[model samples]
Target: MDQQNGVQIEDLLKLKFVSDPQLSPDGKRLVYVVKEINEDKKYQSNLYMMDVATKKVARWTSGKSMDINPRWSPDGSELLFLSNRTEKMQVWTISASGGEPEIVTDMDHGVSNPSWHPEGHSILYQFTNKKDEENGPIIVDQLRYKADGKPSLTSQSYEQVAQITLDTKEIKVLLEGDADYVYSSYTNDGSGIVYVKFEEDEPESYIQSKVYVYEFDQKPKAISEIKGTLSHPVCSPDGRYIAYVGHDQKYSHATYNELFVYDRESDSTQCLTGKLDIQIGDVMISDLHSIDMSPSLTWSNNSEQLYFLASEFGNTELYAIDLFGNVDKMVEGDRHIYQYAMDDDAKDVYLAISTPAHPGDLVRHDINSLMEEPLTYHNEKLLCNITLSIPEPVQYPSQDGTVIHGWMLKPNDFKAGEKYPMILYIHGGPHMMYGNTFFHEFQCLTAKGYAVLYLNPRGSHGYGQTFVNGCRGDYGGGDYHDLMSGVDHAIESFNWIDSEELYVTGGSYGGFMTNWIVGNTNRFKAAVTQRSICNWQSFYGVSDIGYFFTKGEIGVHMEEDPEKLWYHSPIRFVKHIETPLLIIHGEKDYRCPIEQAEQLYIALKQQKKPTRLVRFPDADHNLSRNGDPAMRMARLEQISGWFDHYRLIPKTSRVANI
Candidate 1:
């Protein structure tokens, strides 16, 4: 009943300082991007340079436009980065010491994710062609703004990789993507480049384009003969070898990325991690803010070791694994440490770390002494006054007997045996895992006296590939049971949960599950589904990967078998729903499209089900995470209110926020 128990949602969503940490070649200086969220909730991302030795910080690039992706030249004299300061993104360069940046690329399409060549004469970057502003002859009919109440578009082109000469600033097409291609890293010897391509077969299905090679003299070649998605390719310091992550297409949705290496001379490949049975889920795949779009999979100057971040023992930690296949843990617990970079000498590693209570910040870890040093500090004043709920890792058995891992955040001011309202929060990606990192929604729910439970159900990543892919064709079957069992286990295992006051909420696939949960059962008193897919048939034509992903995940396509699609859709079971539901959607969400929301809302309304559809204008599929801040706050507020309204709390006890 104290004032400290009631936390502001805005305060909970404060921008922390972290991400895009890059170490200079000599291990003396580090450059990173610090993101600032203003009063209007719009963001301004700027570049900051720090002297690792002196521990002094200075803002290198500052403006309204997004300034990020700082890459150090091989010799470490100059920095190459991508910026949108001129309205369109382009390659730019600045002195490592400090000075104005010079534009290095003049192209029609915006340039992004720039990687400096080892020799410093050229740079590699990704650029997507301008979208077809006018309606065009159909190649693909996209889901359009139907979710936001607009017609879908007929066609458009994707962004791809290109090589730009620093001397002339003339860009030569390296890989023109009919699909979206993300550049990872340049070879150590600068002979060619390695990049990940995303082939958009349907709006719902996304296949990581396999690794392709672009020799300096020859056209780009598809290096992947194995036929799956390849990403985060970084070469060893010797240039004789290359390391990358490969995901087999057969188990695309369910599998984790297996690390592999390619010998340049022998043209042969070897699996570094032996056939990984589990998917490498929760390994923050890319760092767009860094000059090198590929994450810091640093090739320890000796080329014998590779240092990268991976989730182990339920937390994302710094890990060093040798090319010969040995893994060692470096750090753990404080926060999710991602976007790391190491100097060639490999004595120290620079990273961006953030937690629920702390915004992100750039920090350095000395490999030899096992000491961590803080660099630039942001949001220190804001976080200093707040009391945060620490999340505890918990495991519960699923219906089919699989044990699922999850985290529970008890309210800040807790009392034993006082049953509290509960919220079962599900994460998206179906392949993504909800670990120990801090989350605003979880804190908000617990602050309001609701026990929060989030689990890595049947299909979540962080376990191996087989575990991640477990929910593929059995979406509503085992996955649903896993979720229900998690809920059941929470009531039985945790004395804090009130059995009579259960609620559910999720987004994307999680949202689809929310729709499914409400349709099949009414155990939860209320539900909120965000950017969800209600009917599989319509999703195929509407979402960006809809055509293929829909089929892959559900084992049915709109063309060959419409019945299978319908049966797998949540709308098919709408008639059996009894729970009050709130459907939240973004007006600009192309991934799930607004129609999915409209369909469910209309069907439920027709049945007189208590339902409300809240739409965010100009928001995309990631409304809660990367969408507009104001809109994100609004969404949390609305959903929390909906749950509070329907929650059956004890009348005799003193009601406290926490």
Candidate 2:
């Protein structure tokens, strides 16, 4: 038998990530976004079309910038998308048969969430108003003034909903205020637009958004009366109901978004999946591509049923709910359905799916037959040459007897009786699940002769709401124990694991956990924390959503509970750290803010605790996943080399070296 080499960091650049599959009005053709790393070391996403029956694919757009948000016009004669071909991102239109795209909207700020009217003569887009620069000094009067990867509030603008007539190119602002509006879709009669609006005047507006119907030349009316955060407002084709994804703030930021339907005729709202317990909407975490916001709720043509993707037990599957509140699983498997598009008939579904074996591909799913047929193989050739590791699912009880779900990826070229160093990889969204999905980082580690262990702790989604919210008020307390216990379980279950050669790494929330683990224990020999939050006190002011996020996640206000914030912060316990640490941060990371990493690095350096800080230029919090290709590979190389340097070599290998 011949040995296949493991996947290398360079191989990651070659993998193609497909997303935003949109079935045409005729339901025979599909257009989607294929993102790949270009020669320039940056990601370039272009539109691609696929024939449903022939399984043939062709490139539809070519350019230096991204051509995404491919939404087909109602007549299917043209495709509407958001692109940055000009100086700024704007809405553009290209023929359905593939031609040069024409700029449609010339708004000062970039446009997003483009939707076409049912008549196909006009388009609705969302954009923020340009900031008033005439008034020299910028004012910071709002609690939620900044966002990660966006301009600060003082220089920022309010998101407004606008419509443009196709023939005349006349534009009209339908909704404008000190609020951010996300365009969903036009009403059945095309008399109004259904959107989620976040008004700055509301208390805790950052966490609260209402679904509203904005009529032309008329005031907007709220459709969602629930006291919770709401988004993804989708209208049924018949105009009888509005489907949305949200949950009451019973558990604050820990609440899962459940599917709900608003009866337009009855003027009442009903929770369809309140008892389902699973988190509704896409929860798949990937390092291969960036997923933009799209409509998650799709209604059947008859308006009798609604279909949505639900994150359950670690994988995303398609689920359907009827108007009567009967829930049925439409598609269930170990693969992640990141995005999907329903045909005009609503009988077939085109899905962008990723599994442990492949990065992503397009598939045609028959709702009635409950079968899926492969539609495109974008990475078939690249994957054939790569040796990928399959993860083995494991469940173990934490220190507090809470069951933790995790997976262990053995080295690609596993040898019996041979010990392999293990790496514990934590996910960013502490609320996100590490499920049965393709994780390039874990695969790369295994390819490099390292076992990778990842788990969904109490704070992670996929479990019931209670389990997901368990870690809200206790960031590093129970969640920390769950991770450590998972590591212990992995070591005990895998006899070939070299327990002493264990390493740890994570980003965002995971990064915070990595910092917390090092401060509380010295089990990990080396650690790499990326875009981590070290000081909650400073994070509340510096981060884009820090003010509200801190209160929701840590369950404390910076003004009222300064001591608690300091106590839960990893920097407070920095003196106890002994692991050789590597801090990786993005210069433009407004989420955690680069200062988070700086504070930890300086503290570790002051104590001479063997630390190094690597700051990526022009990169944000998503640097690991969607940053420059060169930087992504560089990060992986650094992480692998750091682990290799600190890993304990076996006696026989040590003797051979000597």
Candidate 3:
């Protein structure tokens, strides 16, 4: 808790990210991945284990490699994980007791989702059946041709599922063909494997995806009765029920995912968390963690109570749901538990948690007694000398009189006599929550003497379904006013804040709003839009998620309502913008393609508006979060530098300028 120096962009490389806490079967050992940016400006993670009894810690995998996705054998005798110690990421195995590791798979495209079989003899994993692009033209007829971070070419590959035996090293392809198998797991007896298959032959592949339970020598049968997208399907230990996280296509991608259990005995799928009104996953937006929208579901050993993580009003906590439609909040706190794993009987659980003041660390919690204990201090030393800002939870009435929840952070060196400049940060998801998590960007801004404000607007998760769907067809309507109200409330309530020195910035959905705000009003001094969209008409074809996302958000397809799309587009209002705007985007961002930035930049220049576009080469939509270390820091520098260039503070005592 050092207040001498605030958190700077250089600290981004020094922070350690704790994730995917996996408990050993015997409940005596803990294994998880600790990722950090090295001096080389690249991410490196390795598996680390800790003894639950003595609280002792040791490295399971070492060296400069991205070793992750660790899973213990059924008996806890051996462990398998994916590692890039070699050229391409492949499966590697090591004994849980500790020993030298050995490679298992050598696929060209690499393998992922490594899990042990029921008998603990083999491993099941996923790989792409990629066709050689050099051999011929990469022709494709699928609508889902390109994706963010993927090669910019028509996909000539299909997903395949396979298993490898440890003793014989024999590999068998269990599932393959035209469809993309996204997620997979083995049943209790290892008799069948439940996997989510996205059939790419149709136009509505994202919606028509079904969860199938494929048994060896038997055809894969659709177990999910609902016609919606699902992932991370886990079969019960008794093989009686299968639990997964997803939602029907009622709201498409914007739908709040609910936990559903498919009963094999009755052949019926029941929604377990329908009455809870919470998204069944960690939907909080954090730059410190990976981009994992897909939530995980873990069933109890008895198969009666299923444990999962959910977001409610900006707090992601652990909950347990039983068969009788009863849900109990097991671990409630104002913190984000992004990843957790339970012991054999689902009693002793380990959680990776974070808050505003702390980066993140692992904690062990007992399910029955609700007792908790800290297990790791991975970021303690790195953060010991860094002064971090603690967010004050705030709420205000929106334009519709509905209450909007958010957090406000004062500058690191705040004074009562001074007028502090403020910046409003809008989260991208329009559906993701700016929750009680450690955001490196916000802290960095505070370090440079700027108050930070971020709110989970209408389309954000953690709120109820209605609020999340509030912005679906009404983009820039209620969502826009909600943010403006928050800003107005902050300025009026706080006497220390200077309303004239205000600034705004956001990414993706927030980016679009930044564009919208500058176009609509001249209140803010400047604005920064990252990985944003300006024209919906063009975004529909270029963005990877454009087709369905546009239809889902705007409630119309490209041809269905061109005028309506233009009406919601920010580029259409470029002529009204007066604020100096900085457009930051990734060149390889398929989520919000570079063309989106291109259109807005050209339009602003044509109007002779003050604007500049900064594009990071080879970076994707996650440039601000999980991009290369140096690039991430540079992006932060650009954002802070832009705001400081228009510094309304009168060139006072500066903290550290870039």
Best-performing candidate as measured by TM-score? 3
lDDT minimum window of 10 residues, candidate 1:
284-293
Q: Point out the higher-scoring one by TM-score: 1 or 3.
A: 3
Candidate 2's C-alpha runs over 4 A off are 1-4, 132-136, 152-155, 291-295, 648-658
Task: For candidate 3, write residues 1-658 as lDDT tens digits.
Answer: 4345688888887899888888877788889999988778789999999988899999888888999999888888888999998878899999887889999999998888878899998899999898776765667677888888777453677778999998999999998887688788888899879999886656867456789898787887898877777778999888999888888879866788878889988989888777888888888889898757656677787889888888889888988889988988888899988888887767777889999888899998887898999889999887777777899888999989978989999999998889989999999988888899899899999989999999988888888888888899888989999999999999987889998788999999999999998888877888999999899999999888889899999999999999999999998888788788999999899999999998899888888877899999999998888888889988999999999998844422321221
- Candidate 1's residue-wise lDDT over 112-133, tens digit each? 7788888988888877665656
| Model 1 ranges with Cα > 4 A deviation | 1-6, 131-155, 177-181, 196-208, 219-221, 275-278, 281-295, 332-335, 648-658
For model 2 the local lDDT of residue 240 reads 86
Residue 408 of model 1 has an lDDT of 75
lDDT of each: 0.73, 0.84, 0.86
Q: What is the lDDT of residue 637 in candidate 3?
A: 92
Instruction: Pick the winner on TM-score between candidates 1 and 2.
Output: 2
Instruction: Give the alpha carbon lDDT tens digit for every residue of 1-658 in model 2.
Output: 3445778788877888888898888887899998888887777889998887787889999977888889888888999998998868899999988778899988776888888999999998888786756668777677776667774563357788889999999998887877777756799879988988875665576667889986666887898878788898888888888888877788887887877788878989888876788888777677875543233788888999988888888888888889777989887898888888887676788888888888889888887887878888889888777778988999999998999998889998899989988899999877777777788878888988998988899988888888999988798999998998998898888899987788899999999999999888877778999999999999998988888888888989899899999988999888888788999999989999999999999999998877999988988888877877888889999889888877754323321110
What is the Cα root-mean-square deviation between model 1 and the actual structure? 4.6
